[model samples]
Target: MLNIYKMYSEFLSSNIPYGGQYASVVKLLRSAKREILKLIKTFLEKDEKKPHIGKHFVPPLMDAVLADYARNFPDARESEVLSLFAAIINQYKVAMKDEVPRIFESVFLCTLEMITKNFEDYPEHRLKFFSLLRAIATYCFPALLQLTSEQLKLVMDSVIWAVRHTERNIAGTGIKLLLVFLNNFKKSDFCNQFHQTYFMQIEQEIIAVLTDTFHKPEFEWHVMVLQRLFSLVESGSLTEPLWDASTVPHQYPNNADYVCECTIKLLSSAFPNIMENKDLYGEEAAAKLLRERQRMLLVLGLIAPKMTDS
Candidate 1:
């Protein structure tokens, strides 16, 4: 195993003279990385007595990728290497508590700077970057607890940027990443702080997208995100207890009620005749109108309770 790892490190650092040869070598490295990850997973699964996987295997692999390959040839290998890191994060997240901050700096931030100059550039990196973010947010959430305020904001900003992008896959990944965060990190102080900072922004974004015809396919996910957000607000789970030093934002004394009112008013304005006779339309049109009204009512149902509670 150590010999294989040594070979992997050497391959990462090696400068192949031929471009074609380098591409082939990278393909080979990708395959090897996956197999090695599977082996590590199996070792841990089988309860091997001394799986030196985390210490000996992962650290060296990270160093080779970060120091040797990435520094030497910046954007050349990020998409490939980040894919590997994503898998490693899923596999070894528990052991990665202390390492997440460093990994986020080296891999996540570097990739962000590389690809986020414009929406069109580094398209592959854009997709892989969100995938990597999802991996971190999904498996290594506790690791996120270690991040300071600024770092966490950058992470959330990245997700927001992704969800707003024109590309469907990237946007879907971002939406799902938000779902993962909402579902997983329910009551942490950091989670509440994040909600305080960006909940309205995120809520508005999701609402806008949900209403946009372009995002029709993401409708279910949009509904899910709202459901979770509404549930959190309705339950007051996001509120910092009064005993804590932190105070609620004065701009919105009750977030759910504010959102509920805004949403109802928006729906009423957009569909002024929705409350009128659907029977005026033909059968097909009336059925479609009914479906639209039902969907809107479904969303309103989720919000109305919070308004009443507030």
Candidate 2:
């Protein structure tokens, strides 16, 4: 097993065409999956007895695999490489079982770090990275549950970054992942450590993104962010107090005034696009525009009462 890992590591570092070399390596790994799984199972047993896997092998192995993935398949279209890595990680999850917490922590943190470092270099892979994050949130949530407050804050920052991403699809996925994180954890999980101030910052960031005007055709994508914010508001997980008034850059005496001002601004920004070419566009386009306009209104309506009471 060590020999195989060594060979694979060397191959990844060698001067070879990544596409061809990666395909051959994947085939070899697939063919040896059973044997590798057995070996990992044994290593996991040894980890229980000696703590070596957690302390030594798992972190480096995860690092190596992720580096290879990032170096070779830094494009969204490289689905094969993405699938191969996902499969490899899933198999590790299966074999590690009880030992997955440590392994997952290493892998998860590494993945976040990789994304942070390489985000600009591989803009096309943003959605793919987000997809991996969603999988982590879905399948390895227990590991996520074990994150320290600082680590959780890092994750939140990443989610906010994703939500603010320029690409509509990537931002939409970020909203979905944010919802998943919120659903799985109690409000206290985030608020307890960071306090309402941090959440207020998040809300401010989200609202800033939401206020941007997109074309009529891109309205649904904009609505997704608003919907997620609405969900947070409705659930009482994100409260009116957490809405930062300063995000609007207007001098208001109180939160209510600030919110109302922002609400009017949002309405003004959206209304023109919604009303523009209402009769000129096709039925489907008009309907979508109207729906988006309604969604924006709905979000403002939901928050208006709270803002008023504030």
Candidate 3:
């Protein structure tokens, strides 16, 4: 296994250009790298019983991944390097706590730099990037807390960007990643502070995408995230000055009222279009419109009502 990984790492170090005529070779190497990663993951998962695996193998494997990522290949297959880091973090968990910052810069920050400017580029990096975050947030959350304020903010911002992406897979993964982070730390002061700072912004983003006709496929995910957000506010888990902290008087009574008003406005804007165009158009089209309307009502009738009860 070590010999196989050494060969892979040496290839990454060599001046073999990625893509172009070398695309087939790169693809083949990527498959081999993935198999190596799976073996590494399996070994680490059993490392507790076999301490030699942890002591002898995992460190070198992590070094190889960081080195591969540092090569900064323009191709999407660079994402495989991230997958390797994710496997390590998933297996080692808090044992990788001190190494998290290094891993974050190598995988998260580097990948973010590549993909954030244009979601269309490096599509594979986008998926694997968030997947790496999921591994960190789920298995080694304490490591996330170890990051500096600016770094953590970037992490949050990237996830929000992911949620807003037009690509379904990236958006879906983004919402799931957000939910995982929220759920893991919901009981902590960190979660409360996070909501206090970004709750409204996050809520507004989710609402925008939720109402978007193009994002209908992600409706459930949007609702789930919103439900979690509202729960934090309602349960007093996420506290106030939520409206206007700088002024003498608050703008809204609570988070729910603000959300409800937004819902009303959205429904109002969309309602007239449907009413004016009473034509069925077609069975599929009409049903889709009806489903869209039903979704809006679900937000208004079900979710918003519960939110107001808060």
Candidate 4:
């Protein structure tokens, strides 16, 4: 195993061509990966006492091989690299649960940097990239929680950018990442962190986007975001000032009244269009529109009691 690691390390350092030398090196690395995965799987299957596998074996393998691939393989084929990385992450989930945070910290940073820097270079892979981020957020929240303010802000910005992406899959996956993050932290804590960083701007952006697209089919993603926001409010994680009339103006002066009015307007306008074109838009689109509308109404219901008639 050490010899295999040395060979992979040396190959990474060498200026090997992608055709022959690179192929051979990848073959050897794959073989080593299989062997390690087999041992890890055996340990997991038996549910046996194996501190060595977790503490000694898995961490070193992840550091020496997986980290190297993630950090050093910038020019490699994106799909191939992502597949290998995904496999490694899955194995880590099964075999090295304790070491996930440490390993994911290194890989997550590297992946974030790569996606942020080279997104345009591999436009076809944006969904896959965001999927990887969603996985990290889901599986490695402890590591993510430990990130410094600046690092977390960088991540937040990345997800915000993704939410605004034109691709639905990418944007939806980005929203999924935010949902995971929000689920893991208290709303107040996450809100405070967001307020200190990008909450004001993000809040405005989301409202603007929602207002502009509420009547359109593509508004589903924004609707999902709004649902999550409503969840925060209901959970008392998000406060009124963060998203009420003071933040998002409706015709009325009171925040709750304004929200109720906006919800009515959206429902009034969207329901007719949805009813008229129920067949034209197909079941999936119609279902999404109805779902979003219902969610908005539900949010309004939640906040209606607080509305003042002023």
TM-score for each of the candidates: 0.67, 0.48, 0.72, 0.56
lDDT of 2 by residue, 248-270 (tens): 45454544444455556665575
Please provide, for model 3 over 1-310, each residue's C-alpha lDDT reduced to its tens digit, 9 standing for 90 to 100. Answer: 6667667656644535643676677667767877777666666666675446656766776676676666546553456667767777777667777777788776666677789888688887788888888888888888787778788789889989989999988888899898898887785658756766677778778888898877788899999988987776666655554555574244777667765665566556757776567565778887997787667766745646664443
- Cα displacement (angstroms), candidate 2, residue 91, comes to 9.1
Off by over 4 Å in 4: 17-56, 70-73, 76-101, 123-129, 187-191, 205-218, 234-236, 239-310
Q: Give the Å error, residue 58, model 4.
A: 1.5
Taking all chains together, the TM-score of candidate 1 against the true structure is 0.67
What tens digits encode model 1's per-residue C-alpha lDDT throughout 201-279? 7877888888887777778999999898788878777665222224434355565665576568666776778657645
Worst 10 residues of 3 by lDDT: 10-19
- Each model's lDDT comes to 0.71, 0.55, 0.74, 0.56
Q: Rank the candidates by lDDT, best first.
A: 3, 1, 4, 2
User: Distance (Å) between predicted and true CA of 9, model 3?
Assistant: 4.0
Which of the predicted structures, 3 or 4, would earn the higher lDDT when compared with the native? Answer: 3
Q: Which residue runs of candidate 3 sit more than 4 Å off their true CA positions?
A: 1-14, 17-35, 42-52, 247-310
The alpha-carbon deviation from the true structure for residue 2 of candidate 3, after best TM-score superposition, in angstroms, is 4.4
Better of 2 and 3 by TM-score: 3
Candidate 1, residue 180: how far the Cα is off, in Å: 1.1
| Candidate closest to the true structure, highest TM-score | 3
Scored by lDDT, model 2 comes in at 0.55
